[model samples]
Target: MKILIVSYYPLGFGGAEVSMKILASGLKKLGHEIIFASTGHYEGYKNYKLRNYRKIPFFFLRDNLLGNELIKIINKERIDIIHSNGYYTSLAVLKAAKKTGIKSVVHFRDYALACVKSTCLDSSNKEHERDTYRHIFVEYFPLRWIWEFYKWSYIKRSWKKIKQFDLVISNSNPVKEKLKSLGIESTYLANPVDLEERTKTSVKELRKEYKIKEFTILYAGTLEEHKGIYELLVTLKDFLIKNKVRFIIAGKGSSYFKILKYILENTIINAKMIGMKQHEEIMRLYKLSDLIVVPSIWKEPLPRTILEAMQNNKPVLATNVGGNIDLIKDEYNGYLIKNNEWEQRIKELMKNKSLREKLGRNGRKLLEEKHDLKKISKELEGMYKKILIKN
Candidate 1:
């Protein structure tokens, strides 16, 4: 199978990038010919070079112009299957596949199609409201609005073209449900994690490096508000003052600055904002922490960080939303707190080291059973074969 994988961003960071790198590499390992196309270079793919397409201003390019370039790529590559990662990139593949008569598969990694804001929830995460807006409004909206309108138009104009694609793949049940609500049927495929690399960290060394004298809580991912970084910081601040614990945040984002600001203003003592580190370094942090916190306010499709933490035999303390509910078994593998009770929950976990160890063991078992990269990759490969046969 000659597969053409397309993504809008570099593949070194973010959930989408990690997934694509795993899929492309896995496919290659399975004796499939894979060609890559993406917007930028990723540090992870330093050895494997990708063919670069002429960079076009995403906001300024009209629909037809974008479609034409994509069509040319499909025809030129003689691509057998077009696997697109993001929304805009998927649209381009859909357009190109139609013109070139190629089969296409779209991976709906987020809730971009259903919600106007694309986070799968209203600004408040309560109910659908018409005037709801995205958090990064200046960076996304107006352009996003235009893109949304264009997508609608393109779907109407090329309904057959768009629908001819073999399948729509989603990472979680919540994401698939959202797609179904939008009249798009999708298959659920769990994202893959590099379990081999994750399992190599020495827990003893990690604990010594972080100076973890007491129970440590870890949060690894973007510090964005949507990810509930502020909530984690607040919870850590309160939890630490009451209990013997420390919080280590390993990742950087817009909310990193906000967290720094909060730390400075309030003189937060227990929480440490270590900023972004490489993937290997992050794994080491995961090893050090006794528990991992995923306090996302939004309904994340499937957080890769959660999977990573679990794979490292670290217990998770996550908000009960999105695929977190799917991954976590309350009081069994990890503690699932209500969105509002994050701080109180952290404090409870801090006081119970036995519970933390139990949950960590359970989480590791679950990761080995379900979230293993090779296992998930084989499942995805089966799905790809099924889609190709159907098409």
Candidate 2:
């Protein structure tokens, strides 16, 4: 079947973009024709760039124009199904698909609707323990609430559009359950990774290239405050100063300077902040890492970093929240612990090479068995076919 894959951002470097490219390729290999379109940035399969919704002042105009653009493309390309991967694009794409009388399905990759920040964290960067509405005005007052009120209104209006799609997909069970709570039925489709794709850079070469001379623990993601980088550093600073381990942070964000200053001022944690690397470079870094720590304080729908670590046979110590629990079976494959356990888990993993290897192998097994692109592609194709037939 010919498919039009829509996304908010065009050709990009984010995990979702990279994974979508991989997924598109997998679908193409299965004899499905794929045309990729985005709002901006890079290109995709027969890539088309939709108009910038942000530039449009009025909401109805944006939706109608985007939907018209999609309708024209669908008619011209004779597309069978529309698979949208983001909120902005999905909103417009669903409207277009409904008008065109074609199959449409959307993938919800993050919890953007739940919170204004989309991290599902409060003002203090802590996860919301209670109902979001109960704490919204009480916590985020004065400034943040105005923007949040606007966002809440936006989501409330557009959310009903989701029901128009033939199917909805969530990348993790937590996200699927969240969608279910909002009265939208969704399928649990975990993100996919290519198992056979080898990185151009090797561990030995990466070590030499990056000057890795000690035991390394890698954290590859945005350097945002809510990512738990600051918390991780503070929690492990005392342990880091005493150990020979090198903590390599491979990403940049608003917290870049903040994190760097702390590393420079402390002067003894042996933690180095290497600004963002391309996806290919990150895969090589994965091979260089002895262990990866995804210490996100927010409810991550599903972090691709942990999936990458699994693909590279690296054990992980991710926070116990959201999809982290789904991928990690506690002591089986990796440890899903809190900040209090970070230092302990790091220390234990650092000391025991055999245990690390054992856990890493288990993670690799899990990745190959469940997260492989080939396997996931088949399942995706089945979903497309089912929706097409059912309609």
Candidate 3:
């Protein structure tokens, strides 16, 4: 099968980009010829390095010239299936695929369509402003605004074109539910992780590298307001100061500097903000972490950070929202704290070392059973084959 994987950015970073890389590589490994069509080039994944794969620039956003050129590639390559990740790129690919009469599959990785605000929140970070002009004013705004304002418009547009494809795929149940509410059918697929790269870092080495003397709590992912970084900081500051534990925050975001200043001036907790380390370094942080926290205030689809932490044998403490409940069996593998119970839960995990270790072991077992990349890749392969056969 000749497959074309469409994505907006390069595959060096970001959850969606990494997912495309994994899925494309996995399909290629299963004897399918894969080509990555993107707006820009990814840093690490050179075209010559991949098997039965090529990365082509479509430049769909740059005046639609690339979209027409991509149509030419689609016909020339004799592409059988077109898989698109995220919203903007999916819209473009769906358009091109419609013209080429190729099978198109749009994979939903976030809540881009369901929420009007699109962050799954009513407003941006600082204001906590709900139902503001930004939320209500929906006309002639920038591309970002248009995407969020008329998400349903694009969604309906894609749906019209999607009839050419065999299926629509979503990474989480919440996303699938959203699609269903829109009267669009979609298949549920788990996001893939490179388990081999994740498992390469040893716990001991990770601890030593991070200088983790005490029970270190780790948080990775964007330090945005919707991610509940501020709330986590407030909760962890009091708990960690009392328990003498350390906290390390990884990843970059709009609120990174502000959060850093808040920690410096307001809290005495031993905290450090290591902004956006490499992927390998992030895996090491996961190994060193005694517990990982995904304290998203809003409903998240499925966080790759939580999956990576679990795969690294680190217990997770996430907010009881979105697809988190599906991944975490509270008290069995990890703690699913309610919005109000966050501080109490952190304190409880801090006090009980045995409980933490038990949960960590259980999480590792769960990862092997359900969230491992090898298992997920097989599921994706089956989906690809089914779609191909149907087409």
Candidate 4:
């Protein structure tokens, strides 16, 4: 199979990009040819570059090179399928795939399929009320209502394109259900982690390098309030004063400066914000940490960080929301906490090393059975072959 993977960026910019890289690499290893198409900058694959666009009216349609370039690549490469990790250039790619008579697949890793705001929370959730109106109106506007109509129409319109595709897969059940609500059926395929490369690390070396003294916890994802970084910080601020544990917050986002400001102003000694670390660094941290905390307030479709932690033989303490419920077995592989319960969970895990180790082992066992890269890649390849055979 000759698969052309499309995404927004090349590398560890976010979860979607990382998943794309892993999938492409795995498919290539399985004797399938891989090519990449991106509007944003990428450095890791044989890529076709399309100019990144601003979220303005008809920007993708006007001055767009995506469709033509995709058509050219489809013909020249004899591409069997265009597997798109949807982003700004998705509509263009789908249109080109249709025009060229090639089968296409889109893997929805988030709520972009149903939500106009893309976070899946519109008027119901107060936390994202401003996001519902402000983001679309301010970011992509001259006429707000037109943009609003276009955004919603695009969502409905994408449903038509989705039905035309040979295969539509999602990373989690929540995402699949969201699509189903729009009358578009999808297959649920879980995300894979690089299990082979998850090496055991020396905790002493990691502690010395980071200048940490006590039991360590890790928060590895975007530093945004929606991601529950602010909530994590606030929930643990009082606990920091009482405990000698070290907390390392990794990843960068719009909220990085705000988090930094808070940490500085409050003199939170036990907490350290290391910004964004590369993949290898994150895996190493995963191995070194006592527990991984995923305090996501939003309904995360699936968190790759949790999978990574599990792969590294570490327990995850995450909110009981979204696809997290599927991954964690609660007191077996990991513990699921609700609102205002993160501090309590952390304290329990911090004090009990045996329980942490036991949970860590259980998590690793689960990762092997479910999210192993080799196993997932084989399943994905089988899906591709089935689509091709049917088509």
Candidate 5:
């Protein structure tokens, strides 16, 4: 089958891009052809080059302009399917699918399907509220309601168009449930991870080069309060002093100083904050690390970091919320932690080397059974067949 995978974000920006690269590679290996289109960093054919679309009125009509381009491409390439990775581009993609009379599949990855803003009274539970605070756009006194209406209408309109697609796949059960709650029916599909990616560098050499200590914990993401990075430090400060495990925090944000100051104040804690690294660098760090921590306070849709940990045979300890629940099986791959149970879980994995090794192996097994690209390709074909047979 020939497919044109669509996304709004450019390659190397986020997890969606990583998954797209993996998907394209897998599809190509199975004798399927792939074409790509996105917003940034040209990928040969089309680059939407949309900037300032997030402003008041353009955001509502951004997809319409793109729809014409999609129609031309769909006809030109003889594309059989257009698999759209979720974003605000759905209305245009769905319209093109209808016009071309081709099969359409949409991957629902996160909470962008709903929730117009972190400013929607539930800012506390928002996934990336720090982003909201950083770009504090006040609707202001008179026109606040008008801007709010447009945002609300935009999402509501997208919901109406989404049901027109042939199939919608949610990355986690929790996300599927959220879709169902919003009256958007979707099938649950685990996000794909590239199991074949490996570094030629030896772990011992990497340890010496990067000065990585034995029994290390790695956290890679924005250093924001919503991400729970500082909270992770405060939660485990005493434990860090007693244990020899090294905590390495990657990625930076507005809360960097707050996190840095706390670590500096508590000198005995064996923790350090290293700014963001490239994807390849992160994969190497994943190899040197013993444990991966994702202590997000929000209900994250499905964290790619956890998936990467599973890929590297490192166990994940994450909050018991959102898609994190779907990824981690208690006492299986890793512990699905709650606010109060972080210390206890870390202690268990710290003291027992055998237990950590057992859990890590189990995580790798889970990835092979569920998240392997070959398995995902088979599942995709199965779903496509069912859709074809029904149509």
Candidate 6:
């Protein structure tokens, strides 16, 4: 089958982009021809071509033009299906697929379909117990009703477009359930990782390269408020000073400058920021970590970091929310606790090498049994074929 994969960017370093690339390769290996229709370019995918969308003041005109262009590509390429990965590219792809009478698939990797805040967190960076209209209105003020109405309008419009697709996939059960609540039925499929490839880095060499002389805890994600960067810093500031440990923070965002300023002003000597590192470099860092911390204040669909850490045979300490609870069984594969209890958890793990090793081993076992990429790829292949036959 000739498939056109639509995405916001052709090449990106994010988890969704990486997962799509891996999926494309697996499909290609299965003898399917893949063509990319995106706004950006990457050298590895030879069939990549830019399809720029229109900006504000000309949104509908741009979408119409893009949809027509996609229709042209579908006819010219004899495309059998269109697979879109992000919200920005879904409308044009689905419209084109409908026009050409070809099947279309859409993947929901995040909470954008139902929540305007995306993280599903309130102004205080706490997950709302009830995500109802009243709760949303009361959380954000000034013109709460206007914003609330706008979110409803946006989600309703999005759902109308999304319903056009033949198949919709969600990366986690929580996201799938969230979509179901909005009257959108979706297939649940968890994200997968290449276990062997992810742990290829030489641990000894990495330790030497990074000058790792102390027990290290790694945090690799967007350095933002929603990600609990500020909360993490505050919780670990005094603990880091009193203990023989190192905290390595990676990735940059709006909170990067604020974190840097705090670190400098407070003289958090044991903590260090490496900004952003490529996937391979991140894997190497994961290899050196005694434990990985995912301090997200929001409900993450599923973070690739947790899987990667587990695959590398490292115990994960994550907040008790979203997919974190799904992966970590307290005192089993990993620890799931509140953000405030992080200091105590870290100290306990640091003081007990046997406990750390046991948790790490269990985490790897969980990764192989459930989150391996090969198994997930086959499941996806089946889903695609099923959709094709059904249509």
Query: Highest TM-score, which number?
Result: 2
Clashing pairs in 6: none
For model 5, what is the alpha-carbon lDDT of residue 182?
71
Clashing pairs in 1: none
Model 5 superposed RMSD (Cα): 4.2
Candidate 5 residues 57-172, lDDT tens each? Answer: 76646776777778888898888888888856677788888888988888887776665642122445434322232222443335565665666666766777788889998888
Whichever of 2 and 4 has more TM-score, that candidate is 2
In terms of lDDT, model 4 sits at 0.79
lDDT of 6 at 257: 89
Quote model 2's TM-score: 0.93
- Per-residue CA lDDT of candidate 1, range 1-391, in tens? 7777777676445877777777677677777777667666544332223343345434225445655766666677677888888665666677777778777888888776655456745445553412223433433557576665554344334334445568888888988887676567878887776666654646777677667777777888877768988866775665566666677887878778888888778766777788877666777888878778888888877888888887777788788888899899998888788756766666666777787778888987887787677887788788778867773
lDDT of 4 by residue, 302-390 (tens): 99999888887888998888888989998999989865788878878877889988999999899889887888899999999898887
Off by over 4 Å in 2: 11-13, 40-44, 55-57, 129-135, 141-146
lDDT of 3 by residue, 43-138 (tens): 433232211112332223431544565677688788887777776556556667778887778888776555444554654442221233354454
lDDT, model 5, position 154:
68
Worst 10 residues of 3 by lDDT: 45-54
Better of 2 and 4 by lDDT: 2
Clashing residue pairs in candidate 4 are: none
What is the alpha-carbon lDDT for the whole of candidate 3? 0.71
lDDT of each: 0.71, 0.83, 0.71, 0.79, 0.77, 0.80
Candidate 5 lDDT for residue 313: 82
- Candidate 4 residue spans exceeding 4 A from truth: 40-44, 59-64, 122-146
Worst 10 residues of 6 by lDDT: 50-59
lDDT of 2 by residue, 114-197 (tens): 665666677677676323555667776677766656667777677688887898888898788777777788898879988888
Model 5: ten consecutive residues of lowest lDDT: 127-136
